[model samples]
Target chain A: MASNLPVPVAESGDIDLVLRQVLQDVLGLSSERVAELDAESGLFGHLPELDSMAVAGLLTEIEDRLDILIEDDEVDGEMLETFGGLITFLSDKRSDA
Target chain B: MPMAALAGNWPNPPHADEYAVSFDSGRAVRLLIVPALFDEANKLRHFTVEVMRALDRAGIDAMLPDLPGTNESCEELAGQSLPSWHAAMEAAARHFRATHLLTMRGGAICAPTGLPCLRYAPVSGVKLLRTLLRAQVVSDREAGRDTSREQLLENGREDGLALAGYSLSPEMVRQLEDAELAAQDLPDIAQSELGGPGLWLRAEPDHDAAQTVALARIVAERLA
Candidate 1:
């Protein structure tokens, strides 16, 4: 685990880019589709592609890339409601880790 | 013959396998009963069987299904994504109308889909990934193999093996490496409603007290 690496304080734009990339890669969605994602989008209810398996798959990807651990209990749908919320949460987690 | 009792020799049996268990309601649940992953599975056979027998006596129908890419269920490990595995669990739950689901070690996440879940010595997928990556690094270093994180990811490009149990598809690997589960807010979605009561049973003197507490609190709050 790359736990020792200093967490990067990414700008909002950086967060947006990373979040979009993650969504694209994990959910098998295209950038064109993900580009329309806003801060208030519903991941499961809105996106037909985001099933339970996709959720788990997305979590695994995020953990590996961000070098953070997501306990099972932390996996609720609220954190994924909006793109901004997800980014903010990641930013906080990076700083904490 | 009924598949409820262990048929072979105890502990160091000639072979280990999963069988279907039936409930009084006449429902059946598929069980993926194998030894624990790595040496734990091998060493804990007696304890595992004892627990299974106890659960059986309690009238909880259970089965240890064959793992993907192993045993009679020769499903390709590459195709065994988390969703697929969950679906299998859901099928098992449906078969048994299981009110409670239990998993050991790496198989804990497989229990959360439908039934109320009870995890014994559960390990998170993220933690498992980190440990696997770290172990790969250490093993490569010791074995004098030129294995870098980049190489690991690259090898993952073809067919990446998770340290926990099964191998992941390239797409699955990339998805896992890039996405973060903790960042995703789940309570908002009605789907979080599906997570029934979750209880994490830990060994006495758990080293990760903070983590265990956090996990239990999170599950409790969400499922409440």
Candidate 2:
């Protein structure tokens, strides 16, 4: 079985900045939009543009932009249910990559 | 499997960038080839080819165009929408006046207008999203976090949250949250509409035969 380890936050804040940048670009939200977001902020409620089509589109965008492969079987709405959850998921995926 | 290979060897008339291929039935068929999501597209090449060959053998002409951003399609995936993709399929149908359309799994929605659709293990997009949410909840539970599947389902009703790798929007979440495959009450096409020689092939052993029968009945009804 694979070990489930919590991701480590960057002390230098560089990774955080990059992660946020990726989020902004992928979500097509302004920095101001992301500013109010927390780790738990609901992405769907907070961002109206994220429709089912957008969700699929966003997944494709993230895979392309991050150069990470997300299997269809591996994705779920909860993993992206909040900003924090999404960021955490990305962090883990990036580390693994 | 042998039949598929044999069909692949059959000579197909050459056409321009987007043209129709005809069979003895006289129905011009348009091909709407959809790529699988992300890495699965590459991994499932053999299976897709097999399916294409099967369709060809069945006398259903199809074109498996690579989706934008996946194979050779032009549009960046980020810029594409579900409606636009559907529209593209519609365009293919109109262009060909196709008699039938074939799709696999998620691509089942690719049927051209007025033509009967043949889906091999069709998966509803909304259902796919919900299943992903359920899996996440299961993952959380496996990680030692005490979580309930019901709570996870309820969470969709709360505020929309973006899953880590998935970038679900609030509206997307709501749509997925509220989506019920049963409620969609998809018409029974197999029994109603597809009586005139249609195929509904399901994977053996593990797949649900009852559901397959029900779906085939629906397709028959709709296409009959």
Candidate 3:
């Protein structure tokens, strides 16, 4: 019932900003470090700070900020494999919402 | 510069030997800081202390108390529940003669009501529990254990659940599943207000000087 409630649609740029901020906030990466992360930049196993626990926090923070729900089933190594992959996944989710 | 010192023993009901970190200069504007719970607690410990230090510089006294089964308290985590934590916070408020409360994240749930409070990025109990459960699930997957969140919740309600190294009692888990922000309509400080991302979500313990100054100024101005 709560999920059925109307939610605001986030713009594409909003998703990009939210993702970048989540990475910086949850991973404690500096803004410069986050900016350096391009589409090909690896995440997950690449970043030492993005450990399992940090992954949980990161996902939760993203959901809270973007106002979109990320089900556990939707979470996989592919979506979190790179900066571009994550941005695409979130953008898709936002458009679908 | 104000120094960190231990407050006198608070006779917190069944627990009598609890300790708290206080920046006391006998100031009139006193604050009782209820920190984030569990893993977030570890991540935000330094940030919370820094906030307290900033408050000290603002000429206000604040105390960060050890809830039963947390921090320096000797109680077992498996035996503690939300009510127990709320009780401990109430006792701490009374013992410290606190005039206001500073609650962080999940700490907002157990904060003693009726006091003028400053809640920083208050989180729901369900979200907190989910974060812990997800962390456990991730860790288990890495170790090839393959546990689901639903399965973990079932087991948590039956017995105690071990989440991110914290053994939560069934009652605590059950209560947390239904928990939301308790102190409503109070002054809330969102992450944006601090002009940065939340430190509690950080991978490691970290602090920001801007956040410290912003939070201190907010509280000081509120009291002023």
Candidate 4:
């Protein structure tokens, strides 16, 4: 009893790129700034653009774009701490999907 | 954009003027625009306007109405709840005589069950509130303080919680959190099949002529 073909998960790089697009769109960030970000680039407290209001919009955009459900309690400061960490979490979530 | 004062004044100090917009086509068909809630409303304004105009160009009538206690509505957000917002949209639909509905994002929560609707990227209520809560936490961090959901809920219970610049009552949060909404059995969903990217998720608050045209075409072709 096979559960269809195993769903192909996105690579971490691809995940990072897509999440960056979502962040740019949701946070009204310039394409340049979004491009400037790297795995170690700070988020949350570090990036002023990643403020309270923007976080909500950013997460909602991520959910819609990624087709994933982010639970209320699952949100934490760590996932949003760095670009690399966020991408890792997203990659894992997509794999789980 | 013809405006109507659906609800008059807040606090009853003297007079209030809560207004709604109806983009009239004077044609037989009319659409009721239920906007995305909270800060999303501000971000989506350009797109919303573009959609309304596109509808007009397609010879379809449309109405863009502000919910009670929002956007020039003369009422306090502290008194607003999801049910009240739903009822306001329902009343506006009747007032505009809209045959079809066009809801985006959280607006789907207020969609009238019996009426046919065209939803664009419908988001559930819990997702919407979770975003709000995140925004609250971010704001707290900016103020050099860290806050949690438990504290937020406690404050909301007392009076109301200000999240992402919108004051929401505890009742509003409770009902919206409990709500699980989507465009079910709707005539259409404005998806890639409609030939456009999601306008709401675009990077800038600028106009997307291509997407708007595609949306107008979809609404006219499917709903008609």
lDDT of 4 by residue, B75-116 (tens): 788787887777777777776778889897789997765678
Off by over 4 Å in 4: A1-10, A27-36, A40-48, A63-82, A88-97, B1-17, B154-158, B187-204
Interface-residue RMSD per candidate?
Answer: 14.8, 13.8, 1.3, 3.6
Instruction: Judging by lDDT, tell me the better candidate of 1 and 3.
Output: 3
Reproduced native contacts, each prediction: 0.00, 0.00, 0.76, 0.49
For residues A1-97, write the lDDT of model 1, one tens digit per residue: 4354544655446656766766765454556888888878677546765543345445655675667776543444567666767777777676665
List the candidates' TM-scores in order. 0.43, 0.39, 0.90, 0.77
Once fitted onto the true fold, the runs of candidate 1 whose alpha carbons sit more than 4 angstroms away are: A1-97, B1-46, B157-166, B175-224
B14-85, model 2: which lDDT tens digit per residue? 211322222223334434444344323443445455444544554444555544334544444444445455
Error of 2 at A91 (Å): 36
Sequence-dependent TM-score of model 4: 0.77
Number of the top DockQ candidate: 3
The Cα error of candidate 1 at residue B49, in Å, is 2.8
Give the alpha-carbon lDDT of every model. 0.48, 0.47, 0.85, 0.72
DockQ of each: 0.02, 0.02, 0.62, 0.37
Error of 2 at A75 (Å): 16
Looking at candidate 4, what is the lDDT of residue A22? Answer: 77
Q: How good is chain A of candidate 4, measured by TM-score?
A: 0.79
lDDT of 3 by residue, A1-97 (tens): 2353333455667777878878887777778998888899998889888888899988887887888888766777899889999988887787677
